[model samples]
Target: MAVDMKTIEHLCSLSKLSYDEEGMEKVMGEMGSIIDLMDEIKSFDLAYDDTKDGNEIRFADTREDVPEESFPTEKLLANAENTDGCYVVPKVVE
Candidate 1:
């Protein structure tokens, strides 16, 4: 799979980002390397036990769900800019 300039441009357009010529080249190189790494990974045959009564085995170390005590609402919201039992922050955009 090739990582081409068209793909990079499309990604940047969707992300609302711009890059200078030099920066674009650098980003292109990094993206190409990441694609190559992904291709290499795709070609590997990972080892996994597939013979468990003809079904794949699952993890058995999961613990039971148990709720625990947590900090009070007042203490939890202490560092917030403003709160009245609900967190609030300065709006940065319209």
Candidate 2:
């Protein structure tokens, strides 16, 4: 991972982050090491088994969904603008 200032600057702009020169140097070093670690992880070997139905294997481990008691409607609506049991938002779609 050959990191350069140009790449870091571009990444910073995309992430809406700003840093001074010294801070930029520190961030670049940390990001370079992270990228190097990710590159190293690419070398790991793992086995994959496609003979089983993954959905059924996972379904047996899931807990059953059960309905539970809820808070009073008045308590939930106390701090927000609401109408007819729902919060009102400004319409953004035509």
Candidate 3:
């Protein structure tokens, strides 16, 4: 697909952007290059084995969730700068 001035103008209008002739030309060139790259990528013959089992398509090894002991509330609150039985943080909103 060719990136033309009309298309650039339309895109700029939609984005509420104002570009000079030189900037428009630069953007058009970049867009054209991107489109050409996409076309090249689209023409590639990517083949994958479809006979593989669904269970064998694991990207990472899964681990079982094991319950562990946790620290007491008093122990956790001991590290807080200011706590009224809970953590104290700065007021975020008015």
Best by TM-score: 2
lDDT winner between 1 and 3, please give it: 3
Runs off by more than 4 Å, candidate 1:
5-24, 45-68, 89-94
Model 3's TM-score against the true structure: 0.40
Please rank every candidate by lDDT, starting with the best: 3, 2, 1
Q: Model 2, 1-94: lDDT tens per residue?
A: 8689999999999999989999999999999999998898778786667766455557767778888889988788888865657777777987
Model 3: runs farther than 4 Å from truth? Answer: 41-94
> lDDT of each structure?
0.84, 0.85, 0.86
lDDT by residue for model 1 (1-94), tens: 5678899999999999989999999999999998888887776787666564565445575666799888998998998888978998777996
Error of 1 at 19 (Å): 6.2
Candidate 3 per-residue C-alpha lDDT over 52-85 given as tens digits, one digit per residue, 9 for 90 to 100? 6465746567665788878999899998889998
Clashes of each: 0, 0, 0
